[model samples]
Target: MEKSTNLSTCENVMTCPIRPIGSGNEHCPYDWLAVYDGRDEHSPLIGKFCGLGKFPFSIIGTSQYMYVEFVTSPAGPLLNTGFHFNVGNWPGHVETAGIKHGVCDWLLSSDSLKDSSASEGIFLSIAHWYPPNTSCSYHIKGHVGEIVRLYFPSFRINRIESPILKYEGDCGESLTIYDSDHADPARIIKTFCDTFSRPMEKVDFVSTSPSLYVQFDSKTGSYSGSSLYYWAHYDFFNNTRFGDPVPNTLCDEVMYAWKHPGGRLRSPLNSLIFKRTGGSDVRCQYKFVTDRRLYARAIIEVNSVSFKELPYNSNACTRCHEERVDKLVIWEERDKYQNNLACFCDNIPRAVRVISSADQMNLEMIVQGQHAITSYFKNPNPLFEATYEFAHGPLCGPITLGPSPDGELVFPYKKALAMVSGPMAPPEHHYRREKCIWELKVAAQRDLWLNLEKARFADRSCDSAKIEVYLAGRLEPRFVVCPENISLARDLPILTTAELGATGADQEPLPVLIQYTGDGQPGRNIFRLVWTELFHLPRNPDGSLAASLLQDGGCDFRCPGDTEVCIPKHLLCNGIPNCPNVTHTSTLSQLTRHIEWNLEQLGLLHHAGDYQQLVLHDESPEICLKRDLSELPYGKLSLIALGLCLMFALLFAILRRMCRSSSLHQGRHHLQEDY
Candidate 1:
């Protein structure tokens, strides 16, 4: 037989029964078949074979024509089974019509394939056996704003078995894909090898950019049973629905919480089939931020989740021992510890809501162990879908109540409590432990009074409720009250800032914190309290009132003639005169009467006689002056008196000297007559 082709192969020879041949080159002396590079007998002989065993394997010729001849000895045994052989042209390189650059590089473009209307096509490797030490690359291009997707219909390649002696090279065959036109290591999307004993499943690939590069490489030739080949289809289309990509990242994206307050979030290319790259797990973080002030927290509701299932002895959501299973981790990005609020894996049955404690939150999708050929095909679409929204939290107050000296503070703030009261409210168990705080403040140097007007509970026992009052900058509560101690609390005096030691320049705006901890059941647990700003009275170390120049019992210091105006202690002795008629005694009797009245109201009438005597006898200026001087310590009054006497004597001496100078300046005659 003669054939014209670049390459030819002769294989599948059947066993032949013939006279036994000797050995070596002369083994097939009788009934032998010969293969030649040319059609005629004079052509170069490639190989000659014939024997009792099926020994002549496959023969390949790389010439334009291949010739084979078969002959048998006339005296061969009658029981001999004639030899059989098959010859044909080997499979050639892939069609070169689409090649654009290099010998085996092909370029496919959506614009060029516009006539097909679908903008899609398929290509294949050699039909049968592939050439040894060969490489082929395919470049897929799309227009701006368009993305390319590639799918494999059929794939089979020879897997190189480990040899006893190691060598330097890659696998016997491999298929690599890049996200971009260039085959940079960092841009590689995935790589596939025929390492599994069974057949590989179908797979899909997507390009983040407009172009995708695919390369198939073979390090060794294929034998009879193994055909190193594949069939792939590609399409180009617009993908406008993909979220805005994050800068300096491969597949991450940012969802602005402000612009899209409530919307859906999905894994990258949610609608397409994709496999995680080999070697490492694929992680994509969707960050939610901005407009944190508009909401107290973020809520994410997972609609569906699909991932590769992993075997475990315990619950996978709490603890995942398997490294190969995929996971959807939800957390608050603002949390320094990165505590995961919820972790979901495998298949989730019902929708679950994850509420973040902070304003900003993150959802991370992790795809693991998809690099293996079997896994690549089996787990093509491992992804999750969720909806998110910014929402107000259920907790109440860090609220500040101030400027107005007195106001009522109610626990379980009406508005916040209403939010958790309806049919859609959270389960009752969520209110097992709840806390609410309110801060009360007053002007500088003023004391605050707190009185509990009402304390009621649904259970009536109040075992789950307690109220605490704390001074500013103090951790310990000044007073704690509960239903069990209600009688004692009622008997106790009203709580005051002065009594709690929260009075001074440093403690201005005297802040008092009222905190309530309870089950937080709406309307079931409630309380109301009132606060009042009071004047701070100064006391002496002996438990009596401090010595005041004007001993008006009610007022710390009262103006002499103004019964209606009460002067604060700070105003006394200050350079600016705030009181009228400071030297008058007309209002002394009225002031004393007022003092006596205030003392009676304060339940201190036992000291009324002493206060009456102090105001009545000290009304005269001379007596007032003596009493003021007597009040000074460390001999201050004596020093003042001595300094005043010296000042008067010095002034008199200066005046006398000036008069004598004036007389000397007069006419000399008049001065002599005077002398």
Candidate 2:
């Protein structure tokens, strides 16, 4: 019976299935069946049935009638066994005959390494097939200085009882690799076999040369069993010498783009850039890992600096009306849009420093093409660069008390409150997230003053890294401060923070909580505060209550002319009576003049309109209220005035009776003592 066929002249290569040799009880010998391309006995062999050949083989040419012949001993009825073949589309090149995809050898180049909708890195994979006679070969080559690093995450080929112990000999149904541009057996690097003890083992290899050749051959011999196992998984990295990229992270990588030179591992500071001459989309991900308790900061120094396109006409106010050419996006997590930290593009170069809120950050850079192929080739322009590092900690100053020997505190004042830095520095390798909390206290009956002299934050705004001031026993904080207001400390004064005990109540010292966060940007994080323990000043001192209050310095604004009175700035012309007599101004001009001097003194000239309004009545609502009491009927106004007078008279009578009763009680107490 015919054993194998030759279809060398077939126009397209075909995939053929192998059939069992014979019926039950009949066993086939080793090398029982074989198939070749041409009828010429010297033509190269393609596959075989129980021999050193692979199941998936190429069939070539038409008009080349395939010949199948059995090879058996001259003694026993031609072995009474044979094989059959059927044809279909080839497995390796199905989508396109010549185009290679799905885990195949590829030529390394700048254009091929880039990720696109149609392809990825230079990767290859071989699936497990049951038939014993299955063999394949792959070839890879690249330019000079480019080395191939082959990594096999998974490898398993045929369930053989034992692997070939000899290093020089080939194993049964094994895969052979060579570090050469050709299929020269002398250049064999290693041979992998599937043994019972070590069924699967990851394999990694780096080619010393620029080319690599690999071939997988199956030779079942006489061991024809129903069950079989065969598979291999691998990928390649070029332009690098390191082998086996598995179980290793690239946290120390400084450059993520394809073309630019990367930074050294231990470098303290480094910059990353994105540039492309081929006008293709580029995508890369990087993870920042650190050991210290700190945060990270990334500053965009230059973005697309080489691109020189300007507005088309002079009428255009800005020259930034072009298409987006590049983007640098940062994420708190690996997934997109979940915790997107920020997105930097060409326009609106906010020059903002990005702070990582978490211990690790994921960054992705995508360089989009803005022009056509011809445009890019003639004038290729795309550039992006940024620098990143760990930020600094806050500055902790001293806390001094009022006239009480600088930093020392006596009894009742067990705890003294002052401004303290965020926390200690992070380790050398990497920085982590950190938080600090402080408790403040002051003397009894005295008020606590906290002044934030200087403040700097990880971000442009202090939202990510902020200080929360809360009163003791309060579920919510009384004040939440951010760095945006304090980013540039110009002439603006640090608003004074004061806490006083309730009137006539003997209570413990006040307690305030300040929580500081060092979220990544420690180099930029800074805060300085000064706290002073003030003495309790007399509110009504010798009929000079206002003057005493002014001396205490608690008031933000002090009324002129009547040097004896002081009032808060907000209470100025808000339909309230805080200042003494002759305060009513009939015209806007008169009102402005009356408060102009005091307003200027308090640096509140900007708020002149707040108190500049013409009114017919002695007292009117704030200038913004716009309600005129004179518009009301005269009788109605008279009635309202009369009601107010009657209410006051009733209140006075009640107060007089209470005073008389108190005096009578005191007299009785004194008489009892005398008796």
Candidate 3:
């Protein structure tokens, strides 16, 4: 099928006859290759990709999820089934669920891609799982060719491109990204001499079919339960560590296919395990056996497909149902009727009440994480929300995600659970006044449960879980998770500061969240706190505690661990947006320009702080600026002009209509009806 796309051009290396990223052919792509290998998993191949093995298979495109092929030799007795391909720092590694696949494990043979053949590519192992797993095989028909290699950008990352292509041929066809739409993948490929300096924005994928189109009808989130999949590994005393022990480390790769998608096909009478490996584009070649359309009905089949598990982390997280109330109020709450709640003002006018009943604030939380975090399956919309109501009437929503033209002023953050906070004595002394500055790690995004040994998928399949919480901290123990409070109580507390003094406090990681997976593997993630010490713990009148850095109009409130001295201005309102006060002037200081007139017109200038804040909050004013409308860019001037004209026209018409109606009614009533 002929297809094309409008791809944005970016820089890449010089083209060498234009190789696809993993094209197995010639055509340079925009992104450069970072790593390539054909080594056994027992020893991971980690090095800079200067270019090796010709890659033999050019990876032209990728889907949200793809399969890895492993075929058996004629000498093999096991059936074929599912496969795995761990790429880079992602869910990276290959595992087995079928019968033993040793030296003859791969289907891509040495001679598969020799320059002499018409197929013109190497023969690789058939990746499908069979026998011990299940009988499923890929049957390549027509001018069959296979392309095997990782992609720079996985199809899932480019979800925007999905609808742009569809099946045009009468047969349900698929489209493969031949190149960067405008450029080649391989030719632009650059060789990174250093491994530590590799660019991380790109993605990778592998394929077995040489066809541009490999059908991916349904896709699921990547596997999580498997530490073998997380791209991180640990050294453990026992083989079965990380939370719970796994019964059978692996499963057989067997599946039963009752119906085929193409109407022209018959169900398999018995299990079908194609001899996938022995190299050379190893998928079975179908000549229709006798040239029937049923053989043509075959689509790519996946075997030994394993999944991960999910955890509620109810132990570590506090929500409405399970309140960890009264322990600690890390986040603050305010009534919509009173904008002065976060402010120290004694009396706010009732006419311009800060708290209003007109808005619903689902945003009722704030948290501090221990380390890098990940978000699994959180089925909530407006996933992140923050509201700042100025003494003025305007409320600014949290910064919207996507391309930020003004650049990201507030730090981007991720959410998860980690090990640092359980059953431990608080630190003795806060840090001495270094700088008035304190920065928290809101940019990295996730937390982790590290040093796991065995992973068993429980509640796998389409189910994933997250850890969201309320303002309260709990005294009760967390559920099933091995946090500092739980995991350490076992063998952790025994280890001391002397033992780990050089190792930065020996903090154990905790599980924050888990994404979707199958019954065999489960996922866990967490959040991190870079630094958050500005808010002082104040002694409330009732012997309770409140977050404060100001006392009696001074900034002498006591600070927390490793935070001895903090500038009072830095400890404002829950320590977000780095604004000391929740008002109009403070918010505007973060912007480039201002227009204070708009606030005055709205009767909302009470919180302008000073004249400076007034200007920042309103870039569009009630009166005209010095610049001429015609001289300024049309796009900018037209918008403001249109808004003003519309406002004025609306007011005039309302007043005019009222006067005429009133006059007519007065005349009729005064005259009295003759009848």
Candidate 4:
């Protein structure tokens, strides 16, 4: 098929001499080629082209397997004519996975324009022709946990010779992007048509999911060439959530530009000072929405927020009055004038209540900075810090997870147990500054057991500033623990244990609420909790294995060295010393020696930090500790003498061993002959 190799031009390097071939010629009337995405014929179909069209066409393929099938109508008559045309530069490489930099790895330094596909990096570009009344869709799936980012350097749709191309409504040609596989209209992240005036605004479209889909459509419009000059420069990055913050919308502006309509301004914007610029007023608006059923009672907590003073730009807020300027307003609804829930100016508010009945909330921070003629663009200092979350109930406070006290919780028993936020305790400093709550419900068959590894708090200060664990249907707490008291204990203390009856026992599932109250200390309160569901094993009268409860608790095999700790059956003979001294047999010693010997041979006798680094396969280690004897402070003669001594020693040993073996063999042979 006829195809354009160059990304910029459509003219071929070699053109047909403008002479028509004879009718009797057996050459194919149509010029066509099928290009695949991968290296070989088995690769996915990228596109199919016909005639001398699709010039300046851009197609990406893999390095080794990208195959091209050229089709001819009559098979082989024009073969004798030896007609050839120069195609443009080879198609660039496309990366489906792996790390990528800005530079294209497909371009070799020696052969700059070689026709080859790229086998490395995670960057891809797409520039294709959209035939009339036709639609082409592309689905790019990145490695697991990765998000795709597409950058459009140049975008044009339905370009003609007369009027300049510009973004117009209902354009005949359009390009749509989706964050997911299904291309529903509501799910359209961004739609492009015509063109942008401001250098295209460097629009970066990011996929919230690991997969991104792009569709190019043309509605039988008149155009000189292809409807779109859609060259996309894109890469894949690991996905992150709100807690991590770095990879979230607030941190990476381009990656999260499509979070709201028309993109968010100064995203990841938190605690930055605001100064008046020119004649425009400075106001920052942030709107957050939560699922109505999922987050019914939500609140935003802002601590230690105050508009005080700055060094040089102190005069920036000259126009803002202390009583009514540079303030933050919280709104329960979109109508800010009437639905303002709370406003804070020059002082921090404890907590701003978000409207529970609705699914959306708006936050607006205004800084009426005084216009300074000389100091115009000074960076603002941090204004405040806030966090939003849903509370279980009004009694448990806004920081607690789960519903209110009256809300029913049902947890089912499972074979495996897991913790949501991990078993490790949060930072002690944060515990003192904030109050946190957690609620857990165990299934009816669960026999829940709670253990505290460590707890530390104020020493005998007040009982009110402590942790309290409450069980459902009970007014008194099952356990009132002081972190300081627990810290003084020698061994871990079992906090509580609740056992539910068997099925159809008319028993309610266990519901537990854990709350930690701060003692107004910066770094004095901390605790860790680990809960396990115990299974009652039916042991025989002789105290042997229980047929029914075998492996119920996941630890079935007893350690040979120490029966005190039962290990998982899978851990037995898994190369790890699970049985302590009993498992540390000659096999362990031999494995250790082998590793050490390999390390010595590589001259990298440094202790192995990661076991994978110690394992030697086809790839050799880069670092070694071995030193060359020639580099030492010795003459050439000395080095030669040392080498000669070693050579003689080795030769003598080999001769002695060979002679002894030969003698033994001769003796045996002679005996056999005598017999």
Higher-ranked by lDDT: 2 or 3? 2
The CA lDDT of each predicted structure is 0.58, 0.42, 0.23, 0.43
Clash pairs, candidate 1, are: none
Question: In model 3, which runs have C-alpha deviations exceeding 4 angstroms?
Answer: 1-252, 255-559, 563-653, 661-675
The better candidate by TM-score, 1 or 4, is 1
Error of 1 at 129 (Å): 18
- Candidate 2 lDDT for residue 375: 32
Rank order (by TM-score, best first): 1, 4, 2, 3
Model 4 stretches astray by more than 4 angstroms: 1-81, 94-151, 157-174, 189-212, 217-227, 233-314, 317-364, 367-383, 387-461, 465-675
How do the residues 137-237 of candidate 4 rate in per-residue lDDT, one tens digit apiece?
65655656656666666655445322112334455566777887657777788777644322243465777677777776656422123445555655554
lDDT tens digits, residues 580-613, model 2? Answer: 3323322345333445545454554665676654
Which TM-score value belongs to model 4?
0.30
Q: Highest lDDT: give the candidate number.
A: 1
Top candidate on TM-score is 1
Per-residue lDDT tens digits for candidate 3, residues 1-675, read: 111111114244233233221211132122222222333333322211111123322221112233332322333312212222234332222332112234223222213323234322222222211111111111111122323332332111112111212222221211222212112344222222111224322333222233221111111111121001012111101111111212331101111112211122111111111111112111111111111111111111111111111253334322422343111111112353322112111112221111212221111221112110122111112111112221101011121222110112111112101111123422324211110001111111111111212222222322322111111122221222223232222211111122212223233211121111111110232222112213223457885544462343323222111212222322222222121122323233334222233234333345344444332211223212321232358786799899999999999999999999999999998789754
